[model samples]
Target: MLEHAFVDQDGLHDFVFGGDGLSSRYDCLVITSQRAVEAVGAVLARAPSAAARARVLAMPAYTVGPATAALLASVGFSNVLGAGDAGNGSVLADIIVADATRQGALRCIFFPGRVRKDVLPQKLRAAAAVECDERVVYESRGVEGADAALRAALDAAGGAAQRAAPRAARTWVVFFAPGGADAAAATVAGRRLPAAAIGPTSAEFLAARGVRAAAVAAKPDPASLLAAIAAADAHDV
Candidate 1:
């Protein structure tokens, strides 16, 4: 049922309204980086000053999550707000709509990875004539050939150990995304290894093949996955 991605909009709307309104030079921009804030911070630092730079520099950042907000803060951009503890895109989108209503004109530049969904920008543009732009900073290519070959080899060998006599094997299946879910399923399909999913999305992906997705984490990230695995172990005992 999940559709869109999580974007962070920290105090960006407040900065917009607090500023001298929308600049005739250019207005607010909403940029997102699912890849950690450090990555986005680098992009922001290197981005040319010509293509709506000052606008981004002046406005408070709306990020994809807390990591991104922290990255912005690290880079010295103040007025960040959106994601406080609940770091996700849905919450940020709601904040964008509410803030835009009070601010009048809101421009945005959304920076996304290769796998981002388009619901937020679509919804925001429909609500207001916000100056929104899409910028891609990095791309994710599929793992193939020797690199993937090594991983596949590891799975094939480890998969047997994972499935052995004990159903409660210590094998940990780290699901990063929908694709990662598929990969994990394929790797341990016939094996009796226990799995720990990253989120509902990955769970759904596994469930399609009749695999009961247990130990789902709070979020679809590495740290969350690790936490979920630990919790699952505790519950198992």
Candidate 2:
């Protein structure tokens, strides 16, 4: 069950990500997932729908992946902006900032997770009147199932054990959320796996454990995460 609300918007764009793509659509795209196609639909269906959410769906849908675009089409959002794998907020901010700088209208609605950090929005808002409304569509809390041993195993293998096993190599562990990241960091010492964080705050929390970290995913969005991973991979290679 979820408690949803409809917040009004003033010339803002909605942005969110989950699954493999976007579940919703928007005029100016900033997302990363297939399920984000229904973003506008999901947001509009909430209590007090925003005018931006309603109008953008009717115009064009811009998203980060094919599945999201397809989903948007299935749900009736006609126009879309597809940035493919580059659907993270940083990339989205780049696009939005470019256009906003040109046209001089800087306003956007951010549909983010319950625990999202606001790096991209802050950058964009500095250039324009950014109106962000975060909706807690879902929450990903730390899984209580993880114990000390399991945490050690996960960290040792760099997130997914099987994937990291084959290389017989070192991999970086990226804790996606702050709480879970902190939990994982608390019980460890002399951890071999190099750790990274999805955002600076998570890095700060994890840093208390003597774990050095690099902050990626400036917006706590998957696109940023993926990009950071790719960048790290490149550096590793």
Candidate 3:
């Protein structure tokens, strides 16, 4: 049986929005995750003027994938576009560039997590001369230590022998974010295990810690996670 590692953290709560240069409409609104969409909703909820809210609602919205687009739609964002299955900043940048080339250079506002890569904005500027503004709506912080279940599991798994066991006997741990990787590293304390990551960024985080991921999901979603596990299993075989 696979032992799951859990990181207990205060979920996304800090949100800051509304400032100079922020208006009702933009060429595009880029949201990177469901948390980012939630943050946008929070910002809209606090809008001081109805006209301001209306302006934001009227803007075209874009997201990294269908999941985030669906979340935006649920919150009454009718004009929304998604980059499909491979949801990442890089893919989103490509879509933004292609759209800008066809339609015209666009002014975009980005709602991203606190810890984000500059790839999307850099690509947009380089490929389409698009002007982009960013606001961080949420941040994830790692727990101070492993949760009880994770600690117990690690204890049960024991030392190097278990860590170096055959792939069939090892449970593949899947990390969804860099924070998760940080938590896992703290929890495992140098004990290596078969691991997988949801995307390239998370995989890179693991690699930086000398924990090479067996597989990386094409997208940051549960279905992709399963696919990553299957790929890892195949690699192990």
Please tell me which predicted candidate would have the highest lDDT against the true structure: 3
Q: Candidate 3: deviation at residue 173, Å?
A: 1.3
lDDT of every model, 2 decimals? 0.57, 0.52, 0.69
**What lDDT tens digits, residue by residue, belong to model 1 across residues 1-237?**
112322333333332233443344344445455453444555455444434434555566776545556666667666676745334455567778777778886766566654555666777767764656665544444454534564575567576765666545466655555555654455556554456675565577788755666678675456777887888777762
| TM-score of structure candidate 1 | 0.62
User: In candidate 2, which residue ranges exceed 4 Å CA deviation?
Assistant: 1-56, 59-88, 129-133, 152-167, 171-183, 187-189, 196-210, 213-237
Worst 10 residues of 1 by lDDT: 1-10
- Per-residue lDDT of 32-134 in model 3, one digit per residue for the tens? 7777787677667766677767667767788866667778888777788764744777887888778887886788878777667778778877874588877
**Model 2, residue 161: what's the lDDT?**
47
List pairs with backbone clashes in candidate 3.
none
* lDDT score, candidate 3: 0.69
- The Cα error of candidate 1 at residue 168, in Å, is 5.9
**Candidate 2, residue 40: lDDT:** 49
Q: Rank the candidates by lDDT, best first.
A: 3, 1, 2
Q: Give the winner by lDDT: 1 or 2.
A: 1
